[model samples]
Target: MTQLVGSLPPRWILRDPYAHQKGIPRFPRVVATVLAARGITTRPQAEAFYRPHLLPEYDPLLLPGMPEALRRVERAIEQRETIALFGDFDVDGVTSIAILHEGLAPLGAATIPYIPDRFSEGYGLNLGAIRTLADAGATLLITADCGISSVTEVAYANELGLDVIILDHHTVPEVLPPALAAINPKRIDSPYPFDELAACGVAYRFLQVLYEHLGRAFDDTAFIDLAALGTVVDVAPLIDENRRIVTRGLEAMRAGLRPGLQALARVSGVAPERFTAETLGFALGPRMNAAGRLAHANLALQLLLAPTAAAAATLAEQLNALNRERQRQTEEATALAEELLGPEDAPLLFVASEHISPGIVGLVASRLAERRNRPAVVLSRGPEESRASARSVPGFDIVVAIRKEKALLVRHGGHRSAAGFTVRNENLELLRDRLIATAAEQLGCQPAARVIEVDAQASLADLDGLEIKGLMAFEPTGHGNRKPVLLSRGVELREARPVGADRSHLRLTLRDGRVTWRGIAFRQAEADLDARVDIVYSLQRDLRGDGVELEVLDIAPAAAARPLEIRTG
Candidate 1:
């Protein structure tokens, strides 16, 4: 047994006896215990968390100007007006466009889909694109995943006699865009109870309201799959309504109704029979995202909407190629960004290069934030304007921080954790200074670095098949729900050796008395293990043909003594 580096806070384990006695199932004692630790003790609350309702119970009109938006959509439906969907190039944007298109297409309304080139057009509504759509006889313009911050572009569209309806979920700027109807939950005047919906979620709700207004009977399940794909890929919280959407979406995906999704699953080596959240987030999301990051996002969008098996297969192969190219580009850009840092003492990292794709700056920013444990902003210099992406630690809202420096940015918007902006080359320094100063004032100090949290304490003897089965119950872990990491103390490292081609993996053994378990730590061959140590790990069956072994997340030296103290709440 090994003691892990981190321990669960005592407050998380101690629970109220009264709540436990109120008939909570303890068979999944750890589940109940953890839930109680998180302050969820009642049956109803647990049910809500574990099994979320996919259908919206809140009034759709609660969304800011949603009623007005519905009116416009209903009019377009009745008149058979040519409506154009303007969307971003990412997964959320693509899925939003598809959902709206699917929702309106069957209503005998003419709908056109348009995606801006990330390199040429940048993000959000552009005057050139709007004019082009107008030229194509589109009278009504609906935007998804974007347009919340396109104040000027929306005004331009309105000036051109184009009726614009905005459906978006991003940080609301101080001044609202001048669209005919702006449907956003983040608007300060919004009556919507929850403000955490993703872009696709907002689009779904908008369609739901429009369908209701039109008295159209549409199958809500048809869009759940797309909703789930977008929610999971966008990294939205898998709680509340999002949980319901993803849960049902995963079920639908497993059933293999959509040829495109099935083709993706086949090519990506994800068995439909064994689909889970991990498959969505890890296996599929990246592949789809790769298209946007490296090449045309239309490839991924086409794959998702492909009607025929042969078409899906062809698109899947194309997407696979794009993903490979994305990997190569990401590696190169990440290396360059790291080298650019070169021991800077700045509280924030602002790195820019002309070679990096603007579509992937956000991804690079995320990696930098993880490696440096600071807010990271990455930019790609465009000919006319420079585009940037920002990612931040907890407690620091990058979008809000960027908004505070709006004078230095030409355009900017995003969520609390991540954001994107564009600025002129001359204003880069000013933007950086303003963002740093704002962060210092708002955060007070650098946010605490992310720390590993152990779900339960374990010993080497507990690393059994039954324990592994128990862990499986916590499926589909992500932003809100995470995989449990257990810490074991005083683990005897019987042997250790390098395994990978680059000698980055460590294959070792942990033994306590007669109980011994084989363990492998990826990219941890360099870690020091001269003495007995604690290991934070997840138990996994290796299934390497002959047999299976366990995997270790991290192995660090055990504390000098066990800090043992227990108290009941």
Candidate 2:
């Protein structure tokens, strides 16, 4: 019988040394490996990456409909029109809402922000909501983070004598919406240089262009900070303009110019100076997303718009409480999912239940996919239709698999790793079987072993405080650019003991030759005990004011360390 957990070894792909090559600007070996792995080839490219800058000009305005969108918005601003900002119910949507609300305030427009209910309205635009916005004295409706696929809804808005402007970043549908202007970089006719901007990113750029169109001087310092939050929370690739946005945004955030972010950091126990991509990914983003997942995203948007520190702190506390509930819901849903699909080796894992929260099914799929090392779809079933969120492994595209079953789905769309769909209760079983066969065909007969790519090989002696600090230049890590993973060979463990409340984490003092370093491995209680072992880890500054420490990714006995097969997408 196979054990509940598989024991396949991880594949390590270390980058070859490139700093020694002629014409390449020389950096430390480990830093060079990180750059090389990220494909930073030229000297200018390295310099630009080392000191990334916010773009000085507009690139998003190049999208096909952006010019017209700006013109409509400028006319609305001149007329002091009542504009409604429709947003989704997530961190990205909330942040985008805040940015556009602030962006339009100085332009003499009365902006009303509307975040659809996750349970009631589902994902995108609904006709009833459109009527509600119009009744609220909104003559113009602009959608952020959603509305790219709202074809019939836009036509209805037009019929109601409301001009619609869409600021979205999702994959464009076969037929575009009938909005006055739909600005999506992914549109088939879009000429935007970059197509991966998060919804708030698109909103921020639109503000920049709108200012330009009105002949106004725009200082983008604060709007970019909001955009950075959405970009990081959306897990958009940290490249091109995203790199510029986050890199500079962190600096602006530390300045505490934005009252909401400052208060959020204070209540979240994060020092402004220490905020980074990792901080957003783990601490702040979850709290911002928690309200959207559990109760209402308005609470989060309120935090951003909080007028004073006291108000922001109060809202932050509320959001923090909501986040705790979201965590509990996620844990319950994941346990239920695991129980339903016990000890199975299916290519794709599918689970539908009333136990999962509609807002958290995507998170459940992510958690299951990471654990099972296979594509997972978790559905929160409703009476007439079931909403399913799917997450995929590194190689297989879950969105493509979902597309194959389009005939059975009401609607579905997402990127390669993640997607969602609404299917009737009756079609759920057929959807599962279709995906199983699709997974078998797209992925080979047998799934490849899970792989962990090492970024470089370094000795304990090589990882000084300065080396670790130098590597910190690789800030704002996510999606395309991740924190570097380095391997240290044959390190003897001087002391090892279980840590953390559940005793699932390992705290270690490791020695290699005469050099010693502290290390911690989260949830590594099952690690094999060995006198000497090769450990793959990432470097971080020691919180105790010590030099540096290692965050172990994986550990194996020196003798047992061997290569695993590489599977490419």
Candidate 3:
């Protein structure tokens, strides 16, 4: 047994020896440690986190104006009013549109799904799109994933005599839009319990309320799968209400309900039984997003709703090809943007070029932000106005910074960490200066380096059957609920080598005494590290039938500081 160090909480080393003695239902030690660190102490809370349910505990009427919104939707459903779902072009927007269409189609309501082209019409509720929907005989207009800050566009829809219901999760403006019913958790006056729901989650709640009003019980299992996709892809917190939706959604995805989703799983080589958070984020989500990033996002939407396997296969293949093209473009653009920076360090980075595509500026900005550990903005020169995407570090609020310079922007809106805006080509320099000043003011005197939170320190001998089984309690980790990162010191390195064709990963053998483990670090082969190192990682079973292997996240030289004492039984 290892001894406990000073100031280290004794409970940190107290693993439930009988955790997995009962059956496979035993909670994994790593899972319990992570949950405990995040304030999830009770068994009931852990169970609720792992298996989310759309129970009667939550009431949609709690949302500001939800009752009125439901009343209007109920009226539209009863009268068979022509409803048009105006959605954004991203995955969340597409999934939200599909949810509303499928939920209302069986009620004899005629619904038209309209998604604006990212390159052509840009974002949000445009006056032209509204006019078109009204001309098509749409009496009720429903906006999803967008329209929270569209004060002007909503006024246009109201003037056209269109009854509008807005379901969105973006930040609310100072003055609310004058729509018939605006359903958003961000509303200052909203009484909704949870505020971290994604746009699709908001739409899902609206459907739930609609079902209740119609006195009908709708099976939402199939839709939950899509909800999971949008929620995870959109990077929503996997806790509280979102946890339930994602947990159930993953189950639905594994059961394989929709033809398109099943076909996507097959094409991506992701077995349903072997699915994990990585598969959704790295494999499935990117392919779906590819359609919107390069070409028409409607292709992905159509694929999701595809009724035939043959149709799904064709659409999936097309999306795959588009994804490949997107990768090539992204790589070229990122390399060029990096070259422009040289060695200059600013509070923020602003890169503009005629070669960059407006469709992928956001992705490029995100990558640059991660690499530089500072706020980054990537711009594509438009004919009249230049468009830019902004990504920020955790401590800085880029959206708020952009909003302070609202006088210089034609349009701008997004979350605190990520935002986008359009400005006149002549104002690019002014915008850059204003953004840097705003960041300096808001972020204080010095920018803070990123910090990694570790759950506990462990020796290789501590990773026994009991600890591994206890960690299994926390499944489906993402966003808000992250997997616990364990730091182990004095790890003797046996061998290390580059793996993968591109040499993007590192495979290493770490040992302490007779306990030896093989670990693989993804995308960290090029990182500077000595032969002997301290590693922070999450242990997972490979389960590939070739036996289990440990996966490492971060590795650095073992410092000469005081050693961590551990008490093990």
Predicted model with the maximum TM-score: 2
Candidate 1 lDDT at 151 equals 87
**Cand. 2 Cα-lDDT:** 0.82
TM-score of 2: 0.95
For model 2, how does the per-residue alpha-carbon lDDT over 129-183 read when each residue is reduced to its tens digit?
A: 9999998888899999989878889999989889999998877777888988888
Residue-level error in angstroms, candidate 3, position 498: 1.3
Per-residue alpha-carbon lDDT of model 3 for 308-341, expressed as tens digits?
9999999999888888898899999999888887
Q: What is the lDDT of residue 253 in candidate 2?
A: 83
Identify the runs in model 2 with alpha carbons over 4 angstroms from their true place.
1-6, 15-25, 54-58, 544-547, 564-569
Candidates sorted on lDDT, descending = 2, 3, 1
Better of 1 and 2 by TM-score: 2
| Model 3 worst lDDT run, 10 consecutive residues | 2-11
Q: What RMSD value applies to candidate 2? A: 2.2
Model 3 misplaced regions, further than 4 Å: 1-32, 54-56, 444-448, 528-531, 541-548, 559-569
Cα lDDT for residue 10, model 2? 58
